[model samples]
Target: MIDCGRAKRPGWSPSVHYAGTAIDLLVIQNLDEDHVEDLSELLRTVTVRSVFSNPTVTASALASMKPDGMRTGVSTAHNVLRDFGPGLIGRWPDTGEVQVVHFYCRFGTHFTETNDLSLATFFRWGNFTILFGGDLETAGWQMMLRNQEFQRLLVGTQVFVTSHHGRENGKCAELFQIMRPDIAVISDDAIQYGTQEKSTQWYRDKVKGIPVLGTENAYGIRDKRHVLTTRRDGTISIAVGAWGNYLVTPEKVQNELTLGEILGAFGRNALSKDSQVA
Candidate 1:
């Protein structure tokens, strides 16, 4: 799981619905509260094998997981490119092997805070390259563009994860020119930390003819209806095959079953008739 969290605005832990689930690896791209809320509680529920992130101001936040029988490490720029560089990360259940290309500004760069130190990762499964920009902002993007090692990883990128929750300051038109992604995914909410109008407009004009997908509805944007939001479209899933062929689907969340409906179903069952009478 990458950046396990809900927004830090209201500051609520995730529901217990995932109590029995197991997380093999947890990738904390940024240590921002919004990206890492409920991490303590999350550790209590699921068993995480390892945690990876860039060494940054807030990288120490992951220390809690170490005592929970989990291995955690912060990657330096040289360490990333040398060790976890453009190579096989893992293979999907029924698809091609996934390769991750890592890049960070640990040496000389403009980044001094957590967001800028966020690891810029390129995940490639076959020919489908999905760039996970973390929360990298303008300066960070510029830094990556200058790094020759990072440039080598940007080849054939088609899907982009919008940096800094699609905020205006995170916009990097030059980076977009290099990637030329078909779709940009924004992990943000409708109210706080939402995608900015300027960012969306810039992408539309720069990229041209690509859908900007957001996890929540963002206000003050043109062609509002065309912008795909999770609030309306539900969870979006992209499946890629061994050959790099892909399919994108929006899994709409259905309404929860009412108590009355449950009772009606139980009553209709012959097996429950005796129990009801008893």
Candidate 2:
């Protein structure tokens, strides 16, 4: 799992229950309350093999830096990291053809902010490539860009999960010049803050638009979207095939029960009842 933040509408508990399997790895990107609020609950429910996070962020350090309310979540995260130990920095196991490379940023060195210290993940399965920039901000991105290996990994990223939930602060033009993805996904709630709303167009401009499933406009035309957001797209599921061909399917779609279809079903039921009576 990428991040285990709690949400009222699209909670992770239901999906985890339905899967009926233990989580092999849990990657905590940001140390903020929104990201780690349900950390303790998640640990209690599932048997996670390994956890990957910033090693420098200890419970005591967090308690001192963060507010009082964030103590519980921080404690849980700290305990888990201490117990499991941070997962290896290089290639992860059991992935088959999928190449998974985790890039770690040194905390309390160049940057001390939790967002800047976020872990960046790169995945390449066949031709499909995905880059998850955790919650890294502009400075963090710029710092990572200096690494030649990191730059090489960003070459053919088809799907890029926007950092800091597509906020303006996460926008890095220099990084965009290196990695141009087909679709930019922003995993965030509805527009509660200005940061979420302001950078919509900027992210769109960064990526080449991809064909979005079930997003036909009013004119019966399927719209190609450059950006996909949890606020609008709900749970976004990307299924990549053996040959690297992939499909991006959002949970919420434009497919609704039409009046004509409803009436037809009703009429069919009525006819069946009449025949039975006869």
Candidate 3:
């Protein structure tokens, strides 16, 4: 599991329960509340084998870095890391043959900002590769790009999860020069900040567009999208085959169903309930 956060919904614990699988590893990429809010609840509900995060990021360090001082989630994240310790690096058996790589800036030496200290994850399964840049800013990405190994890893990234929820601050034009992904995904809510709204086009321009299923515009025209967001698409799922071919499916698509289809489903449900009663 990566970054435990919740909004109006009940968070990810319910899904974990329903799936009936214990978390082999929980990767906390950013120390912010939105990234670590449900840490305590998750620990209580299920058994997590290990946790992967920046080792230098202590609760006190995080609190001092933030303008608002300590938050409950940050403290909880620190405690979990202390108790569980850092997860091992290498292939995880639970996740099949997928390989994982973690990247982060050193606390005082490389970055003063907490966002730069965010752990960046790289995953590879067969020819499929994806990158999750957890709130990492331009400077942080620039530093990582200097590393030859990190550069090699970015070469074949098919999907790129935008940092800082696709905020303008996280945009690193230099990084995209080397890493040309097929699609970019932003894990964000409604547009609350100007940075969130402004960077959409920039990200879209960076990636090559992918064919999206069940998505159509208001004019009833279906267009291929280069970017996808949680705010627009409820939940996005990616299934990769053995040969690295993949399919991207979104939980909700725009104009996917008409009013008549919705009403017909409701009518059918009512009839089914009536039949049960009879």
Candidate 4:
């Protein structure tokens, strides 16, 4: 029962997908590889029963990814069904899941459409809420906040993946206050683009005392910077770090606590007296 978690496997833990929960990503944009590299990895390994992507992937590119000539014989109109778009709904009876991934609203604007159309996703996992705000810009968050379904998915978030690598300019300050996450994961490598200071601070500060894991430092699954790895043998949680530390417990509080004054002496005294008596 992980009330909160990150991809911090010690010696060896099973893939999160095997934990009997759905995994969803809020794809914020369709640009560089850093943006989509993780996407490809997740798709390749995870048994994604269903996927929710914004109507952002270009038609040609998406078609190319499927097995050659996979979408053959389908008319362009019907192909659109096979191809997802903004405001699209698809059912997965095998998984018993319904997916609704939205794209940015387009009445006549291009600038707003791109940034605002970031894929904002919500996953229901065993009564816990997980929100993935893809490179969701400020306006996108605000707009979704007004929608009933969006608001419903956002309340009491457990794991909130920060958008755009936690950028500051995306007008995401309000997000810092609203989705007070218990634990936040920032999927950024040590690259110049994804780890910009202003961009990732919210992921650092959005939730008070939230644990933040940067990919560059954690999973050297790419660059040998992995602070830890899981064990496949025995208890399966045997993780030895480069710093000569072994992970005994997987979950640790990773945030700074800020305390505000309790103004009422009467209330404070009552709690103090109870603690002393106990």
lDDT of each: 0.56, 0.71, 0.75, 0.40
Q: Which pairs of residues clash in candidate 1, taking residues 3 or more apart in a chain or in different chains?
A: none
Which ten residues in a row are the worst by lDDT in model 3? 269-278
lDDT of 4 by residue, 81-186 (tens): 3556533334432323423334343323333333455566665533345566666677777766767766566665555656655555454666655566554554
C-alpha lDDT of residue 236 in model 1:
55
Best-to-worst ranking by lDDT: 3, 2, 1, 4
Using lDDT as the measure, the top candidate is: 3
TM-score of 2: 0.81
Better of 2 and 4 by lDDT: 2
**Residue 168, candidate 2: C-alpha displacement in angstroms:** 1.5
lDDT of 1 by residue, 98-217 (tens): 776667765223555667778887787766787777888888889889987676666576567788877888888778556665566666666454457556656655442332222224
The lDDT of model 3 is 0.75
Residue pairs with backbone overlap in model 3: none
Can you give the TM-score per candidate against the true fold? 0.66, 0.81, 0.81, 0.47
Q: Give candidate 4 misplaced runs (Cα > 4 Å).
A: 1-51, 55-113, 193-195, 210-278
| Quality of model 4 by C-alpha lDDT | 0.40
| C-alpha RMSD between model 2 and the true structure | 9.8
